[model samples]
Target: MFFKRGMLVTQAILLNMVQLLTVLLLAPLVKGWINRSNALFQSRRGPSVWQPYYDIFKLLRKDSVIPEQASWIFTFAPYIYFTVPLVVALLIPVLTTFPLFMAFMGDMLGGGFILSLGGFFLVLAALDTGSAFCGLGSSRARFVSFMAEPVLMLVFFTVSLVAQSTIPYIVNQAFAGPALILAPSHILVVLAFFLVVLAEIGRIPVDNPATHQEPSMIDEGRTMEHSGRHLGLLRWGADMKLFVLLTIWLNVLVTPWGLVGSAAPLAVALAITALLGKMAVAAFLIAFIEGCFAKLRLLRIAEYLGAAFVISLLAVITYTMGI
Candidate 1:
C-alpha cells in the first residue's frame, strides 16, 4: 500500500512538471499568433510560429551577464521567479486537475488568495534588486495585485454561493447546478475577473506589456539588469503566468471537464486539446484588447482597478445576500 501510494504521488508530481514545461514551450507560439494577428492588422509581415522556440534555444546557448554591483539576489532571482510561476501554472486546472494540486490548494477561494503570495514575492524580489526600473515595476505590480485579489475572491465566492463549495472542482460542478443561468453576482464576478485579468497580466489601461516607459511598465520594469539565461527564465516565466491565468478562466467559465485527473489516455488527450484551444482563444482576446486600448496614465490606474474592486465587492455582497 505504501509503495503504491508513493508511486502515485511520484507519477502526479512528474506529470505536473511535464505539463508545466509544456506550457512554457507553448508560450512563444501563443505570443507569435497574437503578433501575427496584430501584424496583419497593421499590414506588416509577422514572424513564424517557431520564432519563440528558436529564441529560447538561442538565449539558452548564450552566456549570461551579471552586473558586478548587483546583489546575489538579483543574480538568483530569475530561476526562482521562473520556476514558481511554472508550478503555479500547473497547479491550477488548465484542462484537468492533476489530483495532487487540488489536494493541496484545492479550494478556489484559497487558490485565489494564494496568488497574492506569488504577487507579493514577485514584487519584493524586484525591489530587492535595487534598480529604479525594478522598483517601479514592483510598485505597480503591488497596486495591481491589491485590486486583483479581492475580485478573484469575490468571483470565487459567487461560484461558491451557487455551488455551496469553494473547491474549484465543486464550483465548476456548480455550473450545471442550481442557478445555472447567469446570476447578477455571476455577471459581476465575471466582469471583475476579466478586468483583473488585464491588470494582473500587465495589459492596457493598467500597464503596457511592451513598453519601456520609465515609470509605467510593470512587468518589464523589473530585471533591467538581468541578461542571457536569467532573462530567458524571466521571459519564459512570464509566458507561464499568462498561460496560468488563461487556464483559470477557462476552467472556471468554459470547460470543467476534469476537476480530477483523467484516467484514460483518450480522455487526457482530449483534455490537453481543450486546454490548448482555450489558451489560444484567450491569448487572442487579450491581444485584441491590448491592441484596442491605449495605456492609461499611472494616476488613472486607480480608476480602472477601482472599478474592478467595485464589481468584485458587489459580487460578494450579492452572493452573500442571495440576490
Candidate 2:
C-alpha cells in the first residue's frame, strides 16, 4: 500500500523528466538506427551506429559562419526552432501520466490545437532568415502545416467524440472499461492517428526527412543556413521529435489501460514494450515508405495531405456514430 502511494503524481513528475531526457538523449541513437535499417534494406555496409553522435559532437565544436544578409534573427531562429518543439513535445504524456507539464494538455484536443502554435512559429522563423532557400522552404513548411494540421485536429476529435471528452487520460480510462480493442471506433482512431504521425514526422508521401533535393526540399531547405552548434541542436531536436511523436502515437493505445491499480506493473511494462514495438514497426514502415516512393511535385503536396484530412474526417465520423 505504501509503495503504491509512493508512485503517485510525484513519481509521475520524476518519470516525466526521465522520459523527456530519454527523448532528448536517445534521438541520435534513433536516427542512427533508422539509417542502419535503411542501409540493410539497400544491402550497403552502412555507417556506424554511433556516427550521429560523432557528427553532432563535431558540429558542436565547430565555429559558425553567419551570412552577410542574415539578421540576429537568423542566429536566434535555431534556438527558437529547437526550443519550441521541445516545449510542445515536453507537454505530451509518456510512460504514463507522468510529465513535467502534463497539466498543459488541459485535455487532448486542447493540447493538440496548442501544439500547432510551436510549428507556426518555427516556420515563421524559417522565413525570417531571408535566404532564398530558407524563404522557399519556410513558405513550403507553412503550406504543409496548413494542409496537415486540420487532419491532425480532426483525428484527435475522433478520440474526443468517442470518450465524450478530449482529455487523453480520460480517453484512456473510457476505453479501458470494457470491450476495448474490439471497438471499431478505436481502430479508426488508430488509423487516423497513424496518418498524423506521418504528417508530423514529415515522413514518406508527406515530406522526406532524408533528402535535400531541388524544388521538393522543404524543411531541409530552410535549415540549410544553420550550422555549428545551432545545426547540431536542430538535428538533435528533430531526432527527439521522432521520439516524442512516437510516444504520442503509442499513447493512443497504451493509455487506455491506465497506469495504476492491480494492473500497474504489468501496465507499465507492457506500455513500454508496446511503445518499443510500435516504434520498431513504425521505423520499418517509414523506411518501406521512403524506399518505395520517389518525390512528388511541390504543388501536389496539398492533395497528399488532403487525403489524410479526409481519413481523419472518417475517423471523426466513425467515433460519432460509434460504429
lDDT of each: 0.68, 0.67
The sequence of per-residue lDDT tens digits that candidate 2 reaches over residues 224-290 is 7778987887777677667766666666454444343322556666655655666666677667777
Give, for candidate 1, the lowest lDDT window spanning 10 residues: 95-104
lDDT of 1 by residue, 1-323 (tens): 99999977777776676566667777777767766666665677878867777777777777887666666676666676676656566446554554445445556655555555555656666777677788887877777677667667767767677667766555565664445547777777777878987787777778776678676677777757677887777777766666667666777655555443654556656777777776677777776776788888877878887888888888778877978
- lDDT, residue 114, model 1: 51
Q: In model 2, which residue pairs have backbone atoms overlapping below 3 Å? A: 108-166
Name the regions of candidate 2 deviating beyond 4 angstroms. Answer: 1-13, 97-101, 176-178, 254-274
| Clash pairs detected, candidate 1 | none
lDDT of 1 at 183: 77
Predicted structure 1: lDDT: 0.68
TM-score to native of every candidate shown: 0.85, 0.84
